[model samples]
Target: MRADRLVSLVLLLRRQGRMSAAALARELEVSTRTVLRDIEALSAAGVPVYAERGRYGGFALLPGFQTELTGLNHDEALALLIAGSRRGAQAFGLGSALASAMLKVVDALPESHRDTAAGAAQRLLIDPDTDLLSRRTAAEDVPDAIVAEVRRAVFAGHKLRIHYAAVDQPPKWRTVDPIGLVTVRDQGYLLATRSGDDRTYRLSRILAAEELDEPAQRPDRVDLGQAWQERSTRFRTGGDQVAVLVRLHPSRRDELVATALTVLAEDADADGRLRMELTFQDSRHAEWALWQLSTSAEALAPQWLRTTLHNRAAAIATRYEDSP
Candidate 1:
């Protein structure tokens, strides 16, 4: 690990010239003391690393010092550079590793193609934190320690015990044979099995985790993609899935689709509004989603849903009717 850190330290200085020890520590996720020690080690190894003295002083490599690396063609190099720009690595605690690898990629490209490839990659952006509408995307918060433990169990093929807080349920301890970890839409999930039954736990809801010494009772080789697809199919069809038919203003059509699990059918009404059949995880989910649209959407087919919304709106109106 120290060797990897030492190489990362060198590559970081190589890509970004003249970085202070404090700045280096932040980038490397270490302490300034560790950075100082690494610098001493680098210098002792005959690398011409020097420190400048001033308000903007920092460590830098001597001019013309370059590490020899294999070359990549223009498009190939740009593809890697752009992919490395994505923030997914942070979800798995590989953010620093990804940064270090990208630096090596840039350094490896032939000098003539290096600048152009890096420049072209900068022009394309993928998955910004905020959309064009200015609403910030929600990111799940999973502690570093929890993710580290979970990853260890998954890779080591050991059973894991986690204190998980399932939705609308009190927190509880669970032991499961580890399968694999997956992230979707920035939410992390642990796909495991308890007593031979498939189980999926949200990483954010995991309050604590412990990797057991016992080996996991799972297949030596497994198809994770197929497992996930099977689980998802079960989830989409298993619950008290509620299908609702609704008429929504054309402008709010996207909003309705975003909250629904499936859009079974859709068409434009005579008055230009959209008539659609959608399904949600449950009636509660359906009502909550329709409630958000308020006057812009109306539940047409499900008489129960329409009555519930009507009663809810009437209660609110009654409460405010006597207000000043």
Candidate 2:
């Protein structure tokens, strides 16, 4: 808390120029004594902080203080601004601030570079799909504070206490040593260890979190990227790895074959019917795919899957037939 307060004090002074002890205390929600103490601490730490007494008196940094923005050329600055405006800016609560900052940087650049930067900004457009945006769940809205804490734990090898809720289960608390945070399509996940077992927890499901004092030294020989790859492979291979054969009309073959599932084999008959072998992880997803294909595709599976599909089809037909 004190560290955060100290950082806030510095940023506030940088933006507001000068602030009285009473004003700083009110803004920071700290006592006047605490404000004085903080100012003393800052001054001792070579922060260029100064205090004055009486009318129009307050604390301020010495004149002509300016923060430098370096390393970005004109093109680079425009690209950075465009990228930030796309989605990262909104996700990180830096949109307006970033725009303002970029404007200042652009204005400071030379004429030619500034023009190029302006042109790039005008041409850059990030058109996110409206349908996809609407489908994003609440789990996609991870708070910045939790993300910061997760990063700190990962860097410091500290353990963390997290309150997480899985899809179906009620919310529960766990103590974990965070390994990493992964950004999926729209959501963020925390990969962590619980009593030596590793699992992924959705950041959106985290009700609360705090860093613990205990440090869990990571294995010197372990490669995090490799470990994550292995975990991903296992997840993809989990559940029923069933092989199903389907016959599709030649007209529908291209559409059916374009899905992510691997095709094991294929054959075409003279009658324009095409037979293809496919592997799937679960019956539900496979069935959904077949349903999407409608009358054009028929599953010729491990007998059980075929029978299940047939039974479902018959039931659906009967329901319609029995309805007036």
Candidate 3:
């Protein structure tokens, strides 16, 4: 931890140009004496650090000097800076750690490359919370305390007790063995298990979490990727899947197919509409997808779906008919 603190201390001066001993102590959460000692250690290690006396004067790096982080070229450094710009770390409650690491990265670069790297990173944006369409993503409201506890339990190989609200279920308390944390499409999930059964809890849905004293009852060395894949496969196969046949306009064919779980068959119908056999998660899923296309697509098979659409159209028509 002291080594990390020293590195951070150096990086802080590099980033801020200079800081008073008190400022350094506050930033690193240590006493001013510790900061002065770390400054001595940095100087002894051949860092180009120096001090200036009097008001508005403090410790700073020598002009144009850098403590080159081992083996990273400018481009590789640029890539990492870009990766850090993504606020995804905030979801896992690692924001402060990510910030400190990024400071060290910039400071570690060769002086000739540091400014260029920071400037270049500024030009490249990653996941700006909103898009060109002006649709902003809802921020996940995770309590800092809950995320900290959950993250610790995952890494420490411990069980966790959580107040959870499962999909379509009321909130309830449960015990789980946390395997890992995952963020997808800006949403976070805690990959866990309950009594040896695979369970995935959306981090956003975690109402409260308590790291348990008992050790985890799960595998010590879990390959999270493989476990997630297995769970995903089972979930997909066990869900309600349906095959849909539809007549779609030529221009909308691609869009419809893109939304379906699979496009089983495709052909031109007698009237030139593109006929597509598609797979959806279920009937409700099929209805939602096709309804979005409106007149550009018409569901043909599964008479029940056809009747549902017909009834919807009839109801709309009746509304207007009754108005007059």
What is the TM-score of each predicted model, taking all chains together?
0.81, 0.57, 0.68
Roughly what TM-score does model 2 have, to 2 decimal places? 0.57
RMSD after Cα superposition, model 1: 4.7
- lDDT at position 51, candidate 1: 98
Regions more than 4 Å wrong, model 3: 1-87, 282-284, 301-324
Q: What lDDT does the true structure give each of the candidates?
A: 0.84, 0.69, 0.81
Per-residue lDDT over 1-324 for candidate 3, one digit per residue giving the tens place of the 0 to 100 score: 576677778778878898999999888878999999999998999998999999998999997676654344332343354355355676776655565667766776777898899899889877777889999977687876898899889988999999998767999999999999876666778999898888998998899999988999887688878888887677555678888889899999778877787778999978899988888888788988988898999888989889988888888888899655
What's the lDDT for candidate 2? 0.69
What residue pairs are clashing in model 1? Answer: none
Clashing pairs in 2: none
Give a tens-digit lDDT track for model 1, residues 1-324. Answer: 676677778877777788999999998889999999999999998888999999999999998788653333332343354354355555654555556667777777787997799889899887788999999989787787898899889989999999999988999999999898777778788999999999998889999999999999999998988999999989887778999999999999988898888899999989999999999999899989999998999999689999999999999999899858
List the candidate 1 regions with Cα displacement exceeding 4 Å.
31-33, 66-85, 263-277, 300-304, 307-324
TM-score of 1: 0.81
Q: Give the alpha carbon lDDT tens digit for every residue of 30-71 in model 2.
A: 799998898889888777888777898899887755434233
- Higher lDDT: candidate 2 or 3? 3
Q: Which stretches in model 2 have alpha-carbon errors above 4 Å? A: 1-112, 131-139, 220-225, 249-274, 302-324
